[model samples]
Target: MASRARHGGQAIDGRDLKGKAVISGLGLTEMGRIYGHSGGWFAAEAIRLAIDDAGLEKTDIDGLLVNQGMTPLPGMGGVDLQNQLGLTNLRLLSSMNVGGATAGIMVQYAALAVSHGMANHVLCVFADAPLREGRGGGAAYGGGGQQPQPRGMRGLYTAFGMFGVNARYAMAASRHMGMYGTTNDHFGAIAVAQRGWAAMNPLAQQREAMTLEDYHASRWVAEPLHLFDCCLVSNGGVAVIVSSAEGARDRKQPPVYIWGMGQGHPGDLNRAGWDIETQTGAPLSKERAFSMAGIEIDDIDVCQLYDCYTYTVLVTLEDYGFCAKGEGGPFVADGKLGPGGSLPTNTGGGQLSGYYMWGMTPLAEGVIQARGQGGDRQASKHDVVLVSGNGGILDHHCTLVLSPHPA
Candidate 1:
């Protein structure tokens, strides 16, 4: 198997792992508030489900990748999980903390490992117990009540009362509104559309339909962002099984081939002074992934983008070339993201209305859509999907182009 080359017209290194890997199985816990469950417990259960879904036994999992985020349960890292799961043939173990981009990065590593024969089957899992820590369940700011203080320059940001992820996103939204004439109504359209999708999702956290009026009436979390614009912080676990293309051929379910994968970190707002409002690392990552996949943006049939906030989704749509920059507001205004629209985005409702499994939710939903397992919310075209992950305050990004067959 040859390595997939990098995008951006770069020289082929003959070491990039692109289409050689495929996602054979995906599993998730009952999303939303699951009381009295540790992150480790949820992770273990999700791993079991993924393995079974892949038509394999526990022994088949030789690699494990764990993403416990900033506040992991007591014992949920890679080594701890390897011990907890009682796996005897574990050959690869690692942990990731790229914020929401962790899941996509894990898949990149899994593809590399499986393609190189380092591991036959790799399990990527993520879980968090913000509710178990006596924190405000599903709240985004202050680590859901952990109130973790920032370090270094972020400490300066904290002292000036610029704390919390939502605050930063709010600032970005305000800038976009000022620069491009984006309005609260434009942002509201995203909330309404995602909630509409959530209504059809059985495992979504907030399933009640939301209207533009509801979005305007909702309390403001920040100046430009309302309660509906933010994501739901729920307790749950999501896991995916990655294997070599050859290994996936014998799986019980259809394989969603990893056509392309890439990661980019242009800059971090707190430390790098990057422009958060108008720019993101998504374009860089998208270019690389699409280049390796040998497909243009128009080839995408569905998109499962990381929507930690509504603005995030809008900006990403532009950055990924789905629409021109500054046109995202209008592009998503007319129910384009809802069912029977030009583009069906976040079909499982995404983080805004779906369970916020950090980045895992989008990845799982992408696999489900490509496998044609999305029952009610399934898109009309399911051959190709684009799944993206954003981490930190729009600091890091990872993109994956997946398809039912190798492109």
Candidate 2:
């Protein structure tokens, strides 16, 4: 087992700090829309519930973190949230912005800070109503309170463009089904499998069961990626509370320890940065993460990879050593990722089925698995799990390895 490296009675080396920080509590508002709640109100509800879950008061929180909301409210920063929540004093704070990777990154940062005694307890919050945003449903302020500048085609695209780039690069390597018998049907299987899980989750946005046929017939958001392959905008908030393992054990729920966590962003836009054809980016983050947990890929029982697009999951599967490069398509075939498969994934329906708080929901799902609250979709309930988050066209990535307490 990987033990925390201690120097003069203090843990060192980011990867080896096992069971130092634990998830003491979890909370979420109903995933879909709230007819009466403003965004701030929704956020407050999540925070209050989390504190209650942790069996602590807002006064216990000495650190604060908030997900970057799409629209900036009158007072929407760390200080603003602190004042609204009545947290007396905050020792550390930030608004970590890595898009979908925010929640996992926040947890990692909190773990390190708490382990080092920089702060006692840290609360991470993610709340959003993307549909209320201008592009999807909210206000479009344009630029300088005026119309957005014309970047021609680039200006028009949103998440669509990100997927476009990932798909284009993925297709370039695979050559759109040459030699191998892979087709979009293989990708649809991923969607179908997730929807099956979502159907059982009352919290999922699109709980209607989908067939491979349904996935194929869906409109094309981007070539090689159908509408179903993409995550939908949702209005909801999720919260997690992290504290020292000793304190977590006294909480209402079983503590899920942060065994390993790693993040990597090798800044490279061109081909030299990564090989889209080979689907290899930097594996250093995962290597560090797995090493931290003192476990290997074979030791993990479930995975909740960031699946903004099917291609991203495929790439991550290979990069993380779940399957050999280019084998992800075949690995997911034949209903392998669903209820009884080897790797029961996205038990909360993920961003695909559950709420989309810029991917915070998926991180919550990972924590859900570690605590064995997977309900009907629970898999092996094994000791170890690996959850990954990808942001900004796979530009930013993080991996978290969680394990249940040992008897």
lDDT of each: 0.85, 0.72
Q: What are the runs in model 2 whose C-alpha is more than 4 Å off? A: 1-15, 73-77, 132-182, 271-273, 276-282
Residue-pair clashes per candidate, as listed?
1, 3
- TM-score of candidate 2 against the unseen true structure: 0.86
Point to the candidate with the largest lDDT. Answer: 1
For model 2, residues 1-407, the per-residue Cα lDDT tens digits are 23545789976555548789988878888876545556666677888888898888788888888875564433645677777888887887787788677888999999888888888779998886545433442122112222245355655544234333435434542542453455787778788888888887878888887899999999875566677777656667788888988767667888889999888776655655454443433375686787677787888888888876655666677788877766777888878777777788777777666656765776778778888887887776658878888766566788888877731
> Across residues 1-407, which tens digit of lDDT does each residue of candidate 1 receive?
22445579766633255579999988889877788888888898899889888898898899988999544645534777888789878888888889999999999999989999999999999987666555665343443212266677646765677657778899998988887888988889988888888888999999987889999999988789898889888888999999999988867989999988888788754444556567888877876687778778889999999999999999999988888889889888898888778899999999999998999989999999999989999897988799999998888899988988865
Stretches of model 1 off by over 4 angstroms after superposition: 1-10, 13-18, 74-77, 132-135, 138-159, 269-274
Model 1: how far residue 283 lies from native, Å:
1.2
